[model samples]
Structures are given as C-alpha cells and as structure tokens.
Target: MALYDHLGAHPEDRDGVAGTRFAVWAPNAESVSVICDGNGWNPGSDELWGSSSGVWEGFIPGFGPGDRYKYAIRSRSGELLEKSDPFAFYAQHPPHTASVCWNLSGHRWEDAAWIDHRRDTDWLKAPVSVYEVHLGSWKRPKDGRRYFSYAELAEALCNHCEQYGFTHLELMPITEFPFDGSWGYQATGYFAPTSRFGTPDDFMAFVDVCHQRGIGVIIDWVPAHFPTDAHSLARFDGTCLYEHADPRQGYHPDWNTLIFNYGRDEVRRFLTASARFWIEKYHIDGLRVDAVASMLYLDYSRKAGEWVPNKYGGRENLEAIDFLKELNVELHRDFPGVLTIAEESTSWGGVSHPTYNGGLGFSLKWDMGWMNDTLRYFEREPLYRSYHQGELTFRSVYQFSENYMLPLSHDEVVHGKGSLLNKMPGDVWQKFANLRLLYAHQWLNPGKKLLFMGCELAQWTEWNHDAQLDWALEGQPYHDGVRRFLGDLNRLYKTHAALHATDCDPKGYVWISGDDAARSVLAFMRRTADHSRNLLCAFNFTPVPRPNYHLGVPVAGYYKEVLNSDADIYEGGNVGNQGGVYSEEIPSHGHKHSVEISLPPLGAVVFDALTGQAIPPRPAKAIEAKALPSNDSKRPR
Candidate 1:
C-alpha cells in the first residue's frame, strides 16, 4: 500500500461519514493528538490511538480540506511537541509551521498528448537543453517586495522558455524551504509544494501550462540532508527517529543539517514514496537528485575515526547505495519516461547505468569536472590559455563514460563565485565574446545542455534570492546579443540530428585537430549515427583573429557557416567566411580536403557540410569590424 495515502491527513469516508483521517508515525510518543483551530490547540481534545507498528491514527468528523493542523505528541518523557506533517500535500507559508489540508485530486490536467509523446520518446538520443530557473527569483512583483503567484509565473516563464527554445525547465528545489537564503536547498516539506507561491492546485496549473507549451519540468530533489529546525524532523517523539543517533553518522557538517537514516526500512520507504509522489501527482518529468555524493559515502565531510564503517569495513554507505538503487528501479519501472539525474561529483562508476547491472541507475549525471576545468581555462588571460589547453581537450578522454549533462548551473554563480560573464578574464567586449564562446562550446560538446537563468542575459552580479533577475539589462546591446545568441544556439542544437543523435556514443565524434596549443585552437567533427550529416566545429581562444585559417574536412564540397559566435548580430566583429567555404583538394590536418576561413577572436564557429558540387565563393569585401562597447553604468548592484 502507498504510505502517502495512509500517513498524512486524508479526506476520506469513514464508516459512511465524511471526515479527515489523521495518521502519523511517532512510535515513542506516549500519546498523540490532532492540534488545530478546530480543537482550540488543546493537546488532550482529540487524541489518536497507537498501533503496534508505531503508527498513531484517528478520524475527526466534519474536518476537511483548507484546515490548518499539526500533531501534538506527548513523548515518553511527558514532553509535548507540535510538529508539521511530513506527508502534507500543501503547507502554510514560511513563518507559519502548520500543515494545511489540501486535496490534490481536483485539478483537471490537459497534457495528455505531451505525456503520451514523452513516454514513447528516447531522451538519450534527443535534444535536451535545460533552462535552470528559480521560480521565486526569476521574476518577482514589479514592486520587488513579493513573489509572483504561480499562475502569473506560469504564463511569463513559459513564454520566456518558448521564446528561447529551451526544451526543459529545471527548477531549484521548491519543497517548502523555510529560509530564502538557502534557495530551497534546505527543504522542510518533503511532500508539499511551498505555499509561498500559491496553492497546490495553482502549482499544478503552472506545470500544466509548461507541458501545453512543450516544455518539460525538472525539480531538484534534496534527499541528502535536511535542516535542524526545531519543528522539523530533527528529533521526533523526543528521540532520533528519522536520523541516526550518533552525531558523526547523522549530521552533515557542511550544511549543519541532519542526514536521513537510510538503513531504516520506514525511512527508506518514506523517501522513495516522496520521490514517486512528485512524478505521480505533479507531473514532473524529471528529478535532479541533489548532493548525491554526500549520500554515497559514510565518511563524507568527516575526519578519520569520526565515521563508522559498514559490515564489510568499507567507507561506502551500503545502506544508501541499496536505497538509491531501489529508488531508481522503482521510479523507472513505474514511470516509463520519468528521469532521475544525479548531481554526484565523485568518480563513482556507472551512476547512470541500470540497477540490474550493479549500478546506481540514474538517467543522467552532471558533468562537474568538465564545468570546472572549462571555467578555469576560460577565466585565464588569453596569453596564458595555451598552457592550459588540456582543460578543454581532456573531456574527450571520458566524454561518453555516462549519459552526461553539461551544466552551467546555479552552483557556479553563488557564494561570491561571480557570474559566468564576469568570470571571463577580459575587458567588456572580450568578456562578452568569451562568454559567447563558452556557451557555444558547451552546446557543441558531446553532452546535453543545462544553463542557469540569468547566465543567458550576461548578468554581472551573482544571484541574490531576495531580488529578481536584472530585467532592465535585457535591452542593452551586449546583454541582448548574448540572449539572442543563446536562443539561436538552442535552435541549432535542436534541429541538427548530428549534434544530439549519438550523444552517448563515441562513434558520433571525431577529432580533426586537438593539439594546436600554440594558438589555443581546437577542432572536431560531430556526425549523425549513419554519417548522413556532419558538422565541423572549431574554437579560437585568443583575441587575434586568424585570416585564411586552413581547417580539415572529411569530404570535398561546400561547407555552410551554420553558426558563428563572432557574427555581427551577436555583438562581435563581423569576421568570418562571407557565407560558406569550398573545400580544396589540398590535404590538411590528415583530411583529404581543406577549407580556408577567417577565425574570429575568442570565438567558436560551426560548419555544416553540403555534399553537392562546390559553389563559387562570393566577391570578397572588406568586412568592417565593429568597435566593442564599454560596460554599462546601469549594471545590477
């Protein structure tokens, strides 16, 4: 039986009468009672009877949805504790720690067509570009004092995603966090959607709108740890029921939160149920499992002798491994198209493999190593980039190890890390050019794409949860150029089967030139499974434009300039081949044919091969390079 159906307060017909059935798991409690406005907050007014299985359940007549309630439990030590329901479907807004009764069965869903298509689709071979968003901060009220309601946000966010050509929206954790500063990472409500936005039905409507507009929703799921709030699951019934009794085993030193006891069957069931509940009820297409590295290791963030080993005397959290495998198996088996991605940072093997094969069974793993190395390389001055050429080329060694997603996620721009645009080492124009180069590299790389919200705008300031994105900058030349460039990149990525069809297979990728460290240039070819289409990709990491740069091509024909980061529309020097290049019979870089083109400064360009007779090039003209714009004074503070 589903624990969610029986554990939380459910509107049910008990013995031919309509009422709310309240149930909780507080085994060590001497007595438990339903405390609400209906009972005047009296602990002794409406008591529940306990069962041998550590469950306390009771029914209250005339109690229904929209009622605020909490469990008042008398511990074995005679201490009365009021706690929110762990299985609540909806919660009161922060600063109000009550679980509000909600009926999730009332909303009418209109995404049947989308759901059917999703189930039959193979996402591994499809274009999966994600726009990571923080709904509360993506856009707020014009007054800047309150968050936009779910209904309001749905329309705006969907329009934005559609306009930008994003296939999915990966929202940061929205599971009813108490502190806005935590940015929903420290979740309090496991089963409830934070009421800060709107009602449960309102959230359902938000997702419905996204689906109708052809955008999938992926939420960050934080099953790694939870906060130590007094009214939460830190200590229940005067005992460490949900967490471990030992501090070293139960606590997360980094976040000062309590880790779940995965060894306990009830806790495992609870977490797995919560994972299923979101997909089953909210129609969430994916769950980005957060902080998975912390869960897989017993000695995570712990000193020697601080943690205990398992039966085999190993450091791995055996219980957590089992739980993860089980969770993935059930999620995939029950929900055919639902995706479970792991944000695991370590070199854990087969994280995206199936559980039946002794793997963790995640659908995708965030490519953190590539993100770090690429950023470190891009942050360096152009003169020093040649020495660090390995940063960009090293990905080819294990690019297909797992189903990876190239993520320039929110984690990169928080805690004084600076924004993506600001992290580039250059003046205003060079910074914008480098940022565009970085995005082009990410999209053309052999992985799926996931970019954080404000990154596309080229925002200067790091993300602040208290405020919304810098919308005013959207009209500026540089910022608007970056936005437009990203949208075009997304469109190109989606339309080209050669870019995504065999993303997880090494057969689709081939290196044309990877050892040109002196000029800091890299070139490769991406092809479809059957080699029907091929794209030549090259990047120049310096500010000096290379005119008549010879690059190798597999076949001799006309190569169309599909995308150029240095195009005038993207606020770069109009430096490129006029339109397309004809392959020469001369050999270069081990290829039978070659094309001579102008390589832009600190830019990336893609060329699509046309296998027809070579076309005559247009008459050469002196392309006037535009002057780079200076930094705007109206930057976000």
Candidate 2:
C-alpha cells in the first residue's frame, strides 16, 4: 500500500457496489476491524486483512458518505480499542466520539475574486490588523442556540471584523477537540472541523463568505502535540504510532499531552497533510501555528535530565525544524499569497526568514517580548510609569527582528491575567483613557497588529469560552467610545502608507523622542519609502498635560493633527490643538523645523506633515502655545 492509502477512510466503488474503502496503519495490532452503523457495530464482521505495509484494509460494500464509523483494533497486547478515524472529514458532535464519513467535493465556492486579490497582494507591505477570536464565544445564537453554525458565524463575525477595519480574523483552533474548556488547543480531529459548529461544508461556507468580503481568515494550527484520549491518535493500535515512545521525548509536562514523533516520516506526512488539507480544502488565507516554542525546543518546560536531546546533542528539535521548513516551503510553493505566522515566544533566530536561507520559514513571528513589556508598562499607575519607561523603549532595540506582529492574544486575558481594560491601573475614566492610549501607541508604533476580540469593546471581564461577550454594554457611551476609537485606529493604520508600507523596514521609522521618561512622553515619525508622506506620532503616558511640548518635524508648514485619542468623540477630555499646528523656525529634537503644540493628558496624537504645496505663514500670535491645566481635572467642552 502507498503511504497515503493506509492513513484513513477513503471512498471507493467495490465491484459495482457503492461503498467505502477503509484502511489503517495498525502495525502492532493483533487484529483490525472497521466497525460502523452500517455494519451494525459488529467488529468481527468487517475484519480487515493485513499486508506487508502493516496496513489493514477492508472494503464495505454498502457504506457510503455521511455514515458513522470507527476502527476497532485489538492491540498487540490483546486489548480492544475503539478509535475515531484520524483523517475523518467529519465527527460526531462533542459528547459523542464517532467519526462521520463526509465527501469533500460538494461545496460551491464563489471566492475567485478574493483568491485573485490575495494572489497579487503583498501582505508584508500591506496592513494586517488582525482580530484574534475564539469562535465558540465570539457570538452565540440569539434564539437559545448554544453556538452559531459556521455560516451564521460568517455573517456576524465577518461584519464585525470589516466594521472595525480588521484586515483578517485569526480564529482559535477549530480543529475538532473534545473539551471546550481547553479552548480547542487539545485537538483530536486534525482534518475535521469541530462538529460543534456544523459540517465541513458549513466551515467552507464561512471561509468563502469571509474571502468574498475581502477578509482573510487565519486559523490557529496545533502541531506541537495532541491530547492522550483513548479514541484519538494517541496509542493507536496500542503503539506509539504518531508520538514518541519514550516519555522524555513524547510527553508534554505542562500540557500533559503527547508530543508528535516528528522524526518519523509517516508522522511528518500526517501533520503536513493536515496543514495542507485546511488551506486546499477550505481556502484559508493563513495559519498561525500555536505553541511553536514548545515544538522547537527539546527542553521546553522540562527539568534537567527529563528531556532527550537531538542527535547532535543539542536542545533544538531538529526533526520538528525540518518538518516546519517542509511545511512552510510546500505551503508557500502552493499558495502564493498565504501567510504562515508562528506564535513562538523564545528568542529563536530566523523564524520568519526563508527556508532556503536555513531558516524555519515563517512569514511572521509574534513579538511576545513587546506584548509582555507593553502590558506590564500599562498595568502600572501613571505616577510610577516613569520608573519603568525602559519597558516602552527596549522593544525598539530589536523591533525589526523577523517581521514582528505585536499580539495581545487570548493568552494574556485568561487565567487570572485580567482583561485588557481591567489591567489598566486607574479609576474608571482613567482606565478607559489608558486603554485608548495603549491602542494608539500600538498602532502608531512599528509592527503589524493583532488584538483579541473583546479588547475592542473594552470588556471588563476576562474571556470566558462558555459565554458570549458583553454585548449589552455596547450601547453604553464608554464601550462605544472604545469601539469607535478602534475603528478609527484601524482606518488610520490602513489609510497611511507610511504606517504600514515600511513596517518591517528600518528606514520607515525615526525616533523623535524616546528618552522623555520623566515627562512620560514619546514621539516618533513614520515615513514612506519615497518620503512623500510622513506622520509624526506623540504620546503622553501620564495624566498631566504638556502645554508647550516641542517636537521636531522633517518638513515645515502646517502639521495636521490627523488623529487624536483624546478627542471628545472617543470620550476623552477633548484637549488638543484647534485642528492642526504650525511649525516655526525654531529647531528642536535634531530637526530643521519644529512645532510647539499642546499635549492632551494620557493621550496619543498623530500629526501629518502638509507637503507638496506652498505654506501660508501663520500670524506670529498664532504660533504662541497656550497653557492648559496640568492636572487631568479638566473636562471635555
């Protein structure tokens, strides 16, 4: 039998009879049988004969698509085990473990336009603001339904994403998993969409609708390990078929799951094929591989002498690296515009580099350091923020390292970490202001963006996988303000070529004032490749307003205040320049011309240099900066 032949159940016609061909690799099984509803669950009736390839094959003359089935194998130790098909196209809804036979060739796709747009699009140079979501909780059905089918989620989720100006939706793992409590990380069905959200075709419809709306769908993929459930790939045929036999190499201490035997060719193929199946069958725009650090290092979460080193006596998992490279190379070769992002936390070099250049071959890597530093900084009180200003500046030391995506992922909000809004150490008004300022900094800074779902709504509660977000709060002024601010931020990011065009290039960034910790102020300039446009971004982290803050500008004239996080519309104090500020002959911050402007309390303001036109000089009196109340006691007019 060929390598593909024995992997899972496949449809076939047996001598003029409509049926299905069942095959499985049970090298250590004393006997293997295909037991299904069609066979009256009689294991002996459909006993499969073995071949030299170690695969047991049996043809069922009447079983076709949509039939429920499972493999009953007697382990070499004479223990009977019932397991779902590893390559199952569908599965029984959770609380039921049977695999459902599904034909994949039925869905009608209407996303050719989206496909063409993606093929020609350069994601690296494009704006990629992602809204990370867990499907089960993003939104539940209103009519007393526990979950929305994929089609239902598509309409609702897609609209919300587009409305908020997110370019992509990064869904948490939809790969079939048993417990919703694990949040889909512990996957049992690699090829099947969770039956919790309708069928495989329903998922296809979801992707199709997202693509049609110019939204890229990115799914979380878990290749690091699998749960040790009896009916899963674990201990298949009573042997370590997919995982390593040794506990040191196979077991994950933290997750208590089984690590894949990446050194095995069949295991590599199985994982690689699983990755390919999602993209080829569902037309997903990208895959964000989760827990990559766990897969890359041999000593991850392990004590000394508890882990096995690679053949070269190194801690790096060489086989996993090889498999990753192969997976990336093949995906890139097949899908021209698709992206592969790694949720790798360690300081691994060359993660987003090319495989041909001896790299792991990812398109982007999450900047865990930045996220940690940022959250840590924002969580501090405004008075103590100056002491930890280094947290804000240290990331720029290696900001351009490997095309970073600054992620405030779900991992940050769950398990006592607190929600993004609650993490802000302030009174209610100040908390919302701090969150708004944080988001402003996130977008204005150099890097791509990824914010978890409820962050935009400024949810007070941490994510609960079992419940929907606080939608009733959306009508409130404060939450609506945060939502509006997010929409504006996203639009600003996408609209400005300077903000996104050179996010990965060093030339696009200029540090205007990164050393103003005492004042809790920072300013930077984002430039385009051609220098045709430049946006000056300034942040006042403290609650005190600066009346005469002088910032240098590359060009002189009128600098338009393009975006202000402190604007009243976003429920801020409405403190800012009248509309735009005028630059004078005074030189500051190493620039030829500079502007002295009023700074809002705990706000971020962006100034766009007015260029390509003659400047009308402002009256001398107009250049004078006015003083405002230093304390945040001032209210919006």
Candidate 3:
C-alpha cells in the first residue's frame, strides 16, 4: 500500500507538503528518514507510517517541488549516510553538486506540428540503421574542456546522421553513470539522467529536436546492476539491502557492481518503473537493455564452484527472466509502439521472441555474431583466402535472431579494438576496397543496422570522448564521399520495401551470383523484387580494378546508379566504370528479370528498378593518381 496517498502537488505550492511526494523502496533497515532544506520534521515528525514491505514513505510539510533532498539511511551498525540526489533529472554542478531539477513540462515544443514516427507499424518495420554515439567524445566544442549544448549538437550531429541516412540515434546510457570513462555501462540512478550532458530540459530538448527532424531516439537503460557508491541505491536503508545478502548473489566480478535482487517485488518495481519513466515521462522512442546476458546467468563471470544455482541447480538466474518478461508485457501494453531492445550476447533461447509465445519478449536483440563475423572478416589482411571465409560463421544465427540490430557499437571502437577503418589490412586502396565490401555485404545481409559515431565519415582515430570526431577527415575525398554514400544508402533503405524489418518476408533478400566462397573475392546480389519489381545491390571486393568483370544483374533493361561507393570524388581510382551505361536485355528467371554486366573493381553499387533511366557509371580517367598506395590506407569498417 502507498503511504502518503493523500496529498497531490500543485504548481503554486511552495512547500513540499503541498508541493509533491517522493518515495523509495528499502526493505532491510529498521527505519528510514528524509532530509531537505525546509524540513519541519526531525525523523520524529516525519514517519513512513505506510505499510511495511520495505518501502520508506514520508511526507514533508514545507518541502516544495524544487526542494533538494537526501535519504538519511540507518544501518544495523548505526551508520547514517548523507546520500546524493536519486530522482534528480537535471543536475548540473562543477563537482560534488551534480544533476539539476528539470521539470519536463517547462519546455515549449515548437515541434508539436512534426509528423510522428510513433503510430505506424510499417514505419516501425523499416530497417532501423542506427548510429550509437557517446555525445561527449563523438564531437566536442572547440573550447577543449566544454561539451556541445543540445542546440549545438542538434544541428551538426542530426545533420550528419540525417545526411548518412541513419534512422535512429541510440545514445550510450545517458541516465547518469558515475565514471566519465566507463563508457556509461555503469548506471547509478535509474531515475536521473547523467548531469554530464546538460540540464534535464536540455536532454528533453535534444529529444524534441530529434523528433522534429524525424529521427528516433533510443536510450540505454541499465537494470541489471548499479555502482557501489554512497549516493546510489546500493544501501538505501544503510544495509546490504536491495541486492542479495550473499556476496556471490550481490556482486558482479567484472564490473565490481551490486546486482539487483530481481526476485524482490520492490526491486522489480524499481526496475520496471525505471523503464516506464523514460517512455512515459521523457517520450523516448526505445530502450536498449545493457548487458542482459549477464542479468540471466547466476554464474556470469564465475567458475563452477563460485556461483549460485537456481532450484534446478542450473546456471540460469530464472527470477531475472520473469521480471524481464513482465516488464516487457507491461511496457508494450502501456504503449504498443514503444520498442524494447536487448544487448544480450549469450546463447539464451528465445531472447527476442514474442512474450505471448513463452519468450523473453524483446522487440530486437543485437546480432553479436554478425558484428564478430563481419569484424573478423574485415580485420583480416586482404587475401584470396577470403572466398573460403566469405560465408561468415554468423549468417545462420542472423536468420534466427528474429528481430536483430547489426551493431558496430561503442564496444567495437575502444581500447585495443581500434577504429573500423584501421581494422582492415592492406594498402590504402585495398583497405578501402575491403571496407566497401564489408558495408555492401552488411546492407545485403539480413538484419537492421547500427554504426558507431564517425564511422561513416571514416574517422581514422580510435574514439576518445574528450575529442571531437576527426572532422578534418571530412576534407578528404574518400571520407567525404563515403559519408555521402552512406546518406544515399539510408535514403534507399527507408524508401525500399524489402529492407526494413527482417521478418517482412523471408525471400526479401536473395544473394545471387558468385559463390566462389574462397579466392577472397565475393560477388553477390541483394534482390528485394517481389512479383514485377525489384532493386539490386552488387559489390566486388577485388583489389586492382576488375577490367570488365561480368556481374549478372537480377533484372534487365536500364538499371541506373542509385549509389556508388567508389566514384573518384569518393577518393577512388576512376577505373573500369568510367560512366558505363547498361541498356541490355535480360532473360526472365521465374517471375524476376535478370541482366549481366561488367562490375568495377573495389566497388559497391546500388541500382534502381529501371535500367533505362539509370545513371551511367563514370568513365575511367587518364590522369595520374594521388596517394594511390593500396598499402598506406586503411578502410573504415
């Protein structure tokens, strides 16, 4: 039962008694208390006389809406800690003081007139190619120590993403993490967004700007574990409370964090409510659960003897699974269009299937296998040995993950992992060729897409949060052209029917032509033509320009260039396809038409349905090339 269910806050009320009410769940301690600026109670006048299922509920007579407060949690040891702000949405300070009180209602949304991406199933089904970025590091202001404001970022970042044609922005867990460098994987307060960015309204303003521009916002929410800090939920009532009392039950070895006792109703409510807070209060479009795989296993980072087992003595943590299902069901029920994504990298069965069908119920899961297989293939030194490796080990898994996001997230660009382009081996030309092939394959492969920041622009440096993306790289033809190419790709993807959701149709994407699985050269077609129409994407990964390589087209007549990744302006040698136009007659293959033509070397090309009005490939130039060393350049993965 709720304790102070009587008082309702009104905007005019300056005192907390009439202003608003706040509550926290802490089951272990003997007593719970509250502290604030205008406290008329001294732990005696204010009592959480509410029903005791471990919920500490109290009301202050004079505390108003903006009044800051902290929990005076009492422990068995009589240790009372002065805690940090828990529900602070917009906390901003130089140091000790963080997060501000952001009333979301304060924003004047000029974007109310914008079209919503929230209501349509078909729009939801569209292939969501996201760019997961940690704002601080991706692009910083010129002042060195400062960060870009929501308005500053809205124009540049949105334009950059929109230009690349990515459908969504998956922010690295923005709900405040303690360490600036932990990459936001560790979350402290589920109710408060990290004050590192800006004010509460600033974050909302960012979302509003994104929606107004037609891009979706997906936030990272951590329900699995939290930091072991004093201000955190670790010891609300001054006890080893919310988490399991047992060391193994409470701790995460790798992260050194306290795990949530999901079996507890109050704990479940805290997590489930956290999920609801964003979707309801902030209007966020989706959530990406961080490290869900860890949440499901009792022996997450432990050996046989060092772990806790379920009733069946299995490695699985079954309680966490139930909480996740109920949470998903309730969220979907409340807002049917709200999407839930999981960052599960385990062999957990049915992680992204329908909840009604007895599954963990997630709208999508990250295709870790795809990231691994694709990364491994691109990271290799260019070799004819690739043909044998062309068929990545993760393809079958891709078809089975139901709804999946093929992500090249923050995990792929940090520490020793290196930049995507730097991951490739070979001369610069060969490296770019490899990158072209990798991206082309990704588009053709069956799954939604996600790229980390600066990947499309070909940032040569590994990501560092303090620095801006290597914007100077944009001056280079290769990088600039690649950016443009990516934008075109996004446009084509959103405009196409077959490329949206993987489940739209099993036959949506069919790989045609070269099956030379070895020789390192891979040639294939991504055809999404049902009945009378189709679009074709073909790619060639060979190093030196293929002098008249025959590419069997899926349809005949004139197929125009919808996108070309290797035009000279895009930093390539103008070879083979010096504006070559195809207008040949193709024979019918069942219900589809097929045409055969020569392909340019180291090229990725997309064609519109009609071959007749198709734009001609550029003619080869006779000019001497600049920086033609295939060895010096590394392609962006």
Best candidate, lDDT: 1
Q: How close is candidate 3 to the true structure, as a TM-score?
A: 0.86
Show the colliding residue pairs in model 1: none
Off by over 4 Å in 1: 613-637
Q: Residue by residue across 273-390, what tens digits does model 2's lDDT show?
A: 8888888888999999999999999999999999988889999999999999999999999899999999999999999999988889999999999998999999999999999889
Model 2 whole-model lDDT (C-alpha atoms)? 0.90
Off by over 4 Å in 2: 1-6, 143-145, 614-637
Model 3 score (lDDT): 0.67
Candidate 1 vs candidate 2: the lDDT winner is 1
Per-residue alpha-carbon lDDT of candidate 1 for residues 312-382, written as tens digits (9 for 90 to 100): 99999999999999999999999988889999999999999888887899999999999999999999999
lDDT of 1 at 97: 89
Q: lDDT of each prediction vs. the true structure?
A: 0.92, 0.90, 0.67
Q: What TM-score does model 2 achieve against the real structure?
A: 0.95
Residue 588 of model 1 has an lDDT of 92
- In order of appearance, the predictions have TM-scores of 0.96, 0.95, 0.86
- Residue 103 error, candidate 1, Å: 0.9
